[model samples]
Target chain A: MTRVHDMGGRFGDGPVDPSPEPVFKEDWHARALAVTLAAGALGQWNLDTSRHARERLSPKDYARFSYYEKWISALADLLEENGVVTRDELMAGQGAGPSPLSGRKLRADAVAGALARGGPADRPVDSAPKFAPGDVVRTRRPARNAFVAGGHTRLPSYAAGAVGRILHHHGAHVLPDANAHGRGESPEHLYTVVFDAAELWGAPERAGDEVTCDLWQSYLEPA
Target chain B: MPHDHHDHDHAHAVLPPDPALRVKAIETILTQKGLIDPAALDEIIDTYENRIGPKNGALVVARAWTDPAFRAALLEDATAVVAELGFYGRQGEHIVAVENTPEQHNMVVCTLCSCYPWPLLGIPPGWYKSDAYRARAVREPRKVLAEFGVTLPGDTRVRVWDSTAELRYLVIPMRPEGTDGLNEDDLIPWVTRDSMIGTGLPGRPE
Candidate 1:
């Protein structure tokens, strides 16, 4: 539940390195991204599943993996899980026999159009939003069992259980928690919750500093 | 080529990192399986590597600096306004442009993941994805901004936006003083990727 990937508010990691570099440094990084995007376009697994696959890796390995390495590993895991390819096939870099295609290949010519027309997750719901701007709310501190079973959540560990004010109601959107696990869309009211630094961390930090996060309604309750 | 056991060490030394090799291996296998098209892969890479980048976002920022109407439209509906300028896509689908005033400053981070507006900012920088930045940005934002050589006045209110949903954020950094005469084209260079991300301020004219 409290995985190594969820590194928020913890200390002693060291200073942030502010260096500039190209998006993809090595040739493999670009290839990894390309392969991941291609496989993802197949509609076999959702983004959440891919993310969970990476999180499921051993903490040691997860820590060791670069950004694209994580993506490739997850892609490999998903391919094996979906029976698209075998572990041996992945290892050998060649299939033993002909495999069925996904039939949903993103052609090169359509790349620009596809990117410009991005997927909008907002969905209409039957009910009115529970919270509104200026409403006081407390983030639900997820139970240990729930956290373990939920797979992934949009609620970060640092924001959980903290009290904050709703700065704005962002309308209903697909809940990532359910969408990640192939449960359902389960759209909910999203809010911009603003937490004072003193409220999240402690006093004596900066009095005027605040952290604002877009939190789904399910993750909050009236304070 | 014949398999040679004695050259394994030399082969390993010559090969790239294990991750890179593994990715190449997977790509090869997927291509053989006909699940992935190499041309499509190149197309996707080229789009992000060339077609999309901070320059697109810089144009948006520069317009906001020179034109009050465009700035108002951007702050009100960033998605449509940015799309009007041809910067809308995957992560940039839903954007909320927060303006940095003299009294208040804005910063952005994704504690859960590196969720950035790719169409606006291109691929996120390395530090933005680092554990240190993710963990400390919200806790010690002043310190974090200071490390980036951005020293805000202690009296200014620092607002850190943690992107937890599909709505991506972009900081409409305050227009630097003494730039009233500059046109939108001239102001583009002053706007940096870090400024839009709120890690650093826009470059000042020397």
Candidate 2:
């Protein structure tokens, strides 16, 4: 009864394997893709200009909070600032009854119902394979700290310039990089690549030591 | 999987197949209602997935598993050493790694916006992603764990890691029951995704 995109759905039923070597991209396009993802981490989109709803909090407060908290806080701040909802209204929990314009409930209904009914989209969910099991690739490192929320990001900096190979083509997943552009981007290929510890963080006496990362196609390149 | 709590009301609840579509829907709703500024949402999503997502946490988990001294170091100052690993996911800047002992168990949840220890646990489990897990984990954790097939005896005290301002916490689950005589290479297999989340114990196939 699980949806294809459900958590832990992409990997095969067998024990998850860790063998695709990391792929390294050589061109600017590959690098740009990496930059987009890194920059997207900072939330500077091509067209995104709206400010957050909460503004009175400390800068330290914003950085210390969880990602979703930041979203909620920002939304609240923005809503109040733009006069969409006032402090009194929100604090009072007024006009908070689900807005009719809200499509979450409706969309959730339609999609869940269709998926439940065994619609075409509900066919045994399978991850479309991309990049064969042994394709070598590399990660791109782009300078993306120029925007707001500059530099302090989640994408591992050690992954920059690291090379490995595609061990498994998990499936397409939402590309946060494009979403950061505020362009409403869709999911892209997700892969698990094995990087030699030597290549990523200098040599360890144990030459075979390595790490497997679930990387988006955008972060990969031909090695 | 607990039927007692999940009634038929969820039958009509639509689960978006595409994560992006789901986010889009949230974005659209927020935008239409002017609940959030478009730019801010962009930043929020950006940080959630990129800045505070699971990838960052995976590295920390892997490192803790490998480095004993680092593991001790993490237990002492998880926030600083986790940063030394070069990963600081959203809400990850402040970190606290809690060890799960034979007597006590640990789990994490953000009753708010999926507040997770992404720098250590990666993306949340599906159950963790749901409102039920988030709301219930904080209030009635014992009930929620029972729902997840995790039952703690009354004698055992389950510590629910509520990620917060000064620090976010991750449960370094007990190494599986029968992992003795196993090397790190072989030991990794016992590390089930669930173990990383602290809901289940790691176990080896007989």
Q: Give me the candidate number with maximum DockQ.
A: 1
Give the range where candidate 1 chain B is weakest over 10 consecutive residues by summed lDDT: B1-10
Candidate 1, lDDT over the whole model: 0.81
lDDT of 2 by residue, A92-181 (tens): 334444443233222312322221221010112255645777999887674121222332111334455678877556446544444433
| Colliding residue pairs in candidate 1 | none
Candidate 2 runs further than 4 Å off: A1-223, B1-67
> Which candidate number would show the highest lDDT if scored against the true structure?
1
lDDT of 1 at B87: 85
lDDT, candidate 2, B97-124, per-residue tens: 7777767676665432344555455445
Error of 2 at B37 (Å): 16
| lDDT (10s digit) by residue, model 1, range A14-98 | 8888988888888777888888888887778876666766665556656887888777876776787677887567656776665
Which CAPRI level is candidate 1?
acceptable
Note the Cα lDDT for every prediction shown. 0.81, 0.45
Q: Could you tell me the lDDT of residue A85 within candidate 1?
A: 81
Please compute DockQ, using alpha carbons, for every candidate against the native two-chain complex.
0.42, 0.03
